[model samples]
Target: MSLFLALVLLLPSSLCHRTKAQWHTCDSGFSISATAMARNITHCRKLQTLGAELGINNYSTTPNSSTSIDVVFSALPPTPQGWIAWGVNPGRHPQMVGTRALIAFNQPSGMPVVNTYNVTADTRRGCKLEPSTIEVGVANKAANYSDETGRLTMAARLTLPPEYNVSKLNHVWQVGPRVVGTVPLAHAKTLHNFDSKETMDLESGVGHSQRHHDIGLREAHGILSVIGWGTLLPIGVIVSRYFRGSPIDTKNKWFYAHVGIQILAFSLGVAAWGIGLSLMERSGQYRAFMGHRIVGILIFCLATLQVMALWLKPKMLDKYRKYWNIYHHFVGYSLIVLIIVNIFKGYAILKPAPRWKWAYIGILIGLSCVALGLEISIWFVFLKPDDKKAQTNASDPSKTSNPN
Candidate 1:
């Protein structure tokens, strides 16, 4: 009987040891240290951004009891002087504004240190992110930087409040380029940095990133806006200004072309504007983008007025024709300027790839070159003949004499 009982006890210990060894290897192709291995992490997830990975152990919660769990976070810093951070936001709507972050950085003495910070609204408004005690209880917090692999690993035992739900926890992670003193400077304002927040199921290790939800819609909005306001509308203006008396204006084709292009541009612009409204409704960042939204609305109103004025245009012989022309030219040029400004604002808000911004800049440069060449050619066409006539009269005064 004593030998049989000892065999049963030894069997469970051997199985547990085998399980621990299996989990010590992360799916991200890195191995945790022996200390983190001892945490007995049962679940691990490779995060979607920043080449991050998370591991959790003892993820248990009970009613009216504070939940305690061991967590391990790992990521490679963008630079040796950079820092890495991981956190949870317990707010009803999870975002970076209220995250309880554990930020890890190398001290001036080359020691890895982990500190907790409570990210607040002020932090978003240019306030410095200073280390502070967070609402979530963090114990046994430790960090290590590996020079060989260029990765930072942080481990902490978190004591979440009873009200904090582990099933749908919102987690955020980031890596910044440089650290000043002990504070981590801001990360890059790229799409990847903006998309680091996600909702995770601690028990099953299932999670979905915010990037997957809205990236398609955002791309659609940006493309349409660029084609309509940034490209087509400007082309339409060019046709009206330069094509009117050019060789291509045969049969008044320039007028028809301008109208057609404007109509198409307006249609696309209105669609993009509607999409922008829908996106604003779905997002919680209204305050951050308030200026962009306001400018978009103004552009829509002015463009609509321009389109409607097409029908109210005065005849070329009418006494009011000059006044109408003034209004038309003023409003059209104003719309073009506003469109360009707001397109740049959208770029800032979207924070797309650098190549995208440079592409738009190249397009603007191309358009400006075209406009400048057309202006110089028009001046030569109109002024050169007058100069010739004046020279002929100066040489032979009879050409300027009145027959009467």
Candidate 2:
């Protein structure tokens, strides 16, 4: 590879967490603390430091930064979005692909997620309007949407066409069944100051711009995180070897370290996959996409192979050397790529939430570099050297002789 290319390969493409100003965090004190931005960061740091050393507690940046947060293009915009009056959504938008934002909660210090999204407009769900006694309720069929709390948290807004009022406003709101959590676009809607109205004088259909759903967002996040972690960590280490002088050879400590870490990383990845599955079953209403299901099966199979390889490694050392190498190579590399693709997929499916898509770019690119490095090093150490040594041995058998 060219020097410039090699240099670029080594650099962290994005998501370096290098920018202190990436997020616009402020105190709302809604009696909710995602990270308790309450304690002075200095105190957090001190406690965080001790926690880090002992590997006990975790340090968060907010409701103070304990978790990594992301949103879609709109959600991550400079302005603020509207309120959900419900739980949080993980998906950016159903039609979109890619993470618009991302947030990592849970500090190394064992801090709990401080994010307190409004569970209901009534928090505990005590408020509700009596059925159809209201004229508009019967006319628009809005009564069917009320939950135990009487608030229809599952709703999406349709904006007025630019021509009619030309306001670019979502004055018309569409309410649905009892939505357990908040949709990602709620952030966008709030930031845009989306206003709701019972109906417009000229009623119409659900436009893509105007239509909304109680998107199962929280579950989407778990799906994205698992794929994201799997992608960047594995591929980044493997792909980094494209660099001109990286110490990526198997004989080199870097290679073994990379492999060991990846193996452990994949193992941890299982936990992430489980979290995603749980979130799906909980919030996604058990609706799963083909991609997610297939990816899951692949991960399971790959893991099984990894475990078997570890156990039968010595026994099959000679007979199945080629098969073993092939299994590891294909599964490892494939998993890395699969993870990146899956993350992007989650973003597309989770509409409304925007931050995740953007943050994912940085993460995907940066981690790819790391994975590439590790992957290249393996080839540089084994594939290239092995071929050359075989040729040398054939050319001069004398060099292959061992008197001992």
Candidate 3:
């Protein structure tokens, strides 16, 4: 009986009550840990270099034959209505292929559950889960409330399939309303795709810092482009056309106004272009919005040609002056049309704050109304026959007729 009891004790406790997965505490946050299943994961990555501030609280990996990851968020639950999530991407953007995320949210009953997603490159319903996909169990779930920060911390585990390779992991994070469910992009308040600071061989952890430099750059570019190219340029055109015949200060008042506005607009446009290039560099997404780039470059080139024409302008008495006018008007009008189109394209591509798009559209509508009013006035001021001549010609048919 004694021998049998000793043998029974020697048997692993796993055979009786299942042992919990091995977990080791981490020092990065208030309280964090990695399970034995997680530490065996040899691959680890760090925070994104840009737009990192708006993303995950913490991200780590565990890799061997199968892959596992630990994601933590400090601003998730107890916030009342939103959810937080983290995922791995094949590339540095959330829209990239083979992108998958693990999300956490509190149910209406206040019980929290972890979910997974497959994301696509879209503005709405960008993250999706397969209809038949099952909800896999998560290893450990922990949460904490920090009185110092007045923030709640939540962490969860994800076990990936055998085909998952942690070495190629590109981390992504998002926070959105609880209504999003498996499709976080559909309702995400903020989303980011970032590069880890750690090298593949280093096996080190990285912490994220919030930065809005890229977002600021984007806003500056949009403002400059819309005001300088979209709004001011059209106004300059209208002033040159309508004010040329104005009775007040008719000595090239239109010319001076046109030149001043054009110069200001050109300067702003150049600055906007520079900011746009910088934004593209920071994002490393040069190839994504090819249409916007092409249109923008065309507008810049045509505008530059117009500026040069001002210097090389033909004199009014020159035989080629008519041809010059035609070329100038065609190029100028084309630039305006293209600018309007590209502004809309930018709205669709950037998917910016509602105010940005609405404000731009409002300006565009106002400009269109101004142009229409000027066009109608032009018929009476310039195109219509003189009333005195019309009456004299009506009284004398022979004078009205052209004699051979």
Candidate 4:
């Protein structure tokens, strides 16, 4: 169950989990330094034009530039009581104000594409924001900048972010607005041009590392199944013969090793599985890669059933008894075949036969299948037949027995 839980957490986290540091959050209303604000202007410059392409607004600011930029914050009309604000929200999480900043983008369709920030601020520019300070408002939020054009206004929104401080000479701006990142129909061409031509080489390099990790990890996962369900069980049974009824009840060394190895293999496979899943998400191959998850669930069920069967009735000697052997063989062999078949399914999804993936899977499958066929044929034709004839002759020698 612990292993299962670990696996469950790995999937979604691997797929969609974002780095919190990149999007640090506090209670409510945050601030960012003026220097960090300058970087957005440079990044956003290339992402201007019409229609939506792609955009990004990173909060992690760059330092050392002694420049200030213009900043404007929209605020609620001054109340009769004047501007008011509080840090700890009503029974909700408190926000770290004066340390976070707002970052807005122009993404074409809310996809994760590298673009520039449409909204920015800096100290040297001496930018001024409307209702600049964290204060009481209609939304009870701070520093909200939005693109007024689209039905779904924002391409990305960072809330309760960290780093809300802004310092410029005498003006130290402590403002936290709902960081709004937008992909306006206004900046489509520029974004597309940079995303298509300028970004191809850089992004390809990043994409390569992610894709390679996925393909390798996924392919290795199949090997885990072969080792656990296929090879381990038989090895355990063979070992058990030597210690059929020993002090340690060493019925099968192979079985012991099989179980232990399987548990460990599952652990290792889990690591690989997680890496593959994360890579898939980063590469945007999640749709085609969903089948891998289904296969994992099935493998979990098979492993669970086998474990439960043994735990529920740990009959050491009875395991080798005639009736028990029949049940054991049936269940054990079924699991092996199921795992093997699912491995083939994984190969189909991850590989393109005769291609990189196909060759790897082909080698494993071809060998396992041929071995299984030979083993079965040899058992039925030679081993089992001889045993059966010996039994028949022994029975004939006792002809005096009553038919009833």
Candidate 5:
């Protein structure tokens, strides 16, 4: 029994140590031996979204030549039964459709197999992905899965088509959960899965993620819109409402402040609107954001009218001054409401980090608190005395009597 206990303890430790060593080896670098005619890999890149690595050995006569290359892709599957894939899209856009891929998975008999697939739009619709010839010439294909490290590595030598450029190659990589027989089941529709494509320069190993670039633009647009329409516009309204007639109106400085703030806010809003248009053109996701785009256009038109109304202001003693005031107040308040609603809509569309959404919520709450306090103070300071004077006058019969 003592011997048995010792053996059990040693067995777990040995297995753990071996597993750790294997993981380190796999994560550190690709160790598959190069082909007999292969040159040393000049470039290797860690993909941004998926936890995958790619190593490339370019055999082109020139940097821009469309020659052959050897590539190795390594990644850990989402599950032990899952599969891994790496591919190139010859199209101008880097996406899953129209990709030539090499997919690797293990069979029930524990044998690793790699197959070429020509991914079409139908493949995205859950069609069975079968082994087929691709546009590019493929040879020297091999794949292996390491049980200890849980890593799948696929190596291939590809001959490029005449039109292919070695400097700008669109590549994609993915990991799936399971395979039904030889066919890979659908991968989870997560953000990481959608963001598994990028453009790479095989010669220099430089990669640029299109998703990251788009995200950066979106963040800029969100920030500008929040500051201009959501935050500053409300503050301008508050200043015009409360400070214009208050004791702080020396030299009518409140008017200038309101004007300056509104103009600045409008400028930023216009910039944000322009950026939104650019993003729509680039992404072509207009239908998804139709409501948002319409609301944004409405806000822009109303804001432009408000700015123009500044120049068309009536004189203080003009007969139509009250009508102008009514229009201004109505439009201003309506804009505030629409701005808040559209900001929330943008938050839903962007789906940025949680902290950003919460931060905007906190800003709105703080602004509401300030507005509520000011409203109560205004009622007490201005409206209460007038009400009390009218009551006093009504109580006194002499003061209430009209001069006939």
Candidate 6:
């Protein structure tokens, strides 16, 4: 029992180690000191560790001068044959603007090679690498295998681009397993335009990294949409259909119940729709989820029209009342169907599709079964009995005889 417990305790630590192996976080820092040496290790040691002890130097404020900046990137465990890169950009994420990267990698022969590249833009294929515009020099580079520390200190003298702003200085760093080929086994982070030289940490994760989009906000939007429009819309339909004229439906009780539920749902759904619009604006990827976006718009439009119809509601005796009822019913049902379909489309677009998708599916299945049961009951009580009486009268002459 003691041995079994020990193994179980070690399981989580072992898994964590394996996970960390895929990507090691780089220690980084940024500074703006004119006196800081570009080649000395003491300067980097004095700079604070942003996350895991990475250091960077400030770009020279004096324009047209021969002044330069130093960037020091360190990997915790000496990546004997791995790679590390630091990039500078004018905007937040590296993808936003052209980035110049200073990359240092240990070759298979155990020698360090430093190179430079200009990443103009991120494409559907991958990063578009171009000839760098800045001059790069490796002032100090070393790998101590025994100490498990790999350090690269580089100096770059750049002519500030037209779009570059000193207050909005953005930087990105990455650590990869190899210098060539697809660098998928990596961790990356971007420090958006910071006004001060105070050390700041960036996020790191396994696998390729994209912009720091607000994923949590997007998830909140999804949850709100699924509950308000997806689930509650169907519930409103069921209440209006199955509960009408039942013993509990006193006076306009069914009408009030149905309208209240729908109104509440629409209010929540409108909020969700607004959130969706905000998310789209923030994501900068309007065309990616076209189907989901189109369907969502249609649902909102149809729902809005349905809500407006309540204001123009006609009495039972009006000539156009039947037409109005038909229009309202058709649009409302269509909106519900679109809401459900678009929710699944949303799930498809979500990163690492969450468990809430299954939960919504289960709710949909339950509602559908309840609707089927109601339809059967209504047919048996109202339509089937009338059809049977008509058939009997037509078939038997005695049944049709007049008592008078």
lDDT score, candidate 5: 0.78
- TM per candidate: 0.71, 0.37, 0.55, 0.36, 0.66, 0.58
Q: How far in Å is the alpha carbon of 402 misplaced in model 6?
A: 6.2
Clashes of each: 0, 100, 4, 48, 0, 7
* Deviation from native of the Cα of residue 310 in model 4, angstroms: 5.2
Each prediction's RMSD over C-alphas, in Å, is 13.7, 20.6, 18.2, 16.1, 13.9, 12.2
| Model 5 / residue 25 / CA error / Å | 9.7
Report the CA-based lDDT of candidate 2 relative to the real structure.
0.35
Task: Write model 2 residue lDDT over 1-404, tens digit each, in one string.
Answer: 24532232233222121211111222242111122222221111100100110000122222311221111100111212222221122223221111111111222332211112222233113443211121111111000111222211111111211232211112222112222222323222221222221111111212222112212223333433444355535543553334335553444555456556556555545555665565455433233466765776576566666546656664545887877777676766676667667666655554445775766677667766766665676677868888988999999979888988
lDDT of 1 at 31: 45
Q: Could you tell me how far off, in angstroms, the CA of residue 224 lies in candidate 4 after the best superposition?
A: 5.1
Best by lDDT: 1
Task: Residues 89-187, candidate 3: write the lDDT tens digits.
Answer: 545433334456555665566565566555555433343543223233356765443445433345556665544444444455555554444333333
Decoy 1 TM-score against native: 0.71
TM-score: model 3 vs. ground truth: 0.55
lDDT score at residue 76, model 2, on the 0-100 scale:
14
Worst lDDT run of 10 residues, candidate 2, spans 46-55
lDDT of 4 by residue, 1-404 (tens): 55754564455346533322112221122222222222232222111112222212433323542222222222221221111111212111111122222223223353312122212233212333222323211221123222332211112222321232222111111112122242222111111121111111111111111222343444444444444444444344333433344345555554566566556545544544555566455443334445556666665665566566556554767655667666655766665556556656665654434564555456556656766775576556558777987888778977445778
Instruction: List model 6 lDDT by residue over 21-91, tens digit each.
Output: 12132224322122132333223333211222344344454554343444555433235556655566655
TM-score ranking of the models: 1, 5, 6, 3, 2, 4
Model 2 — TM-score against the truth? 0.37
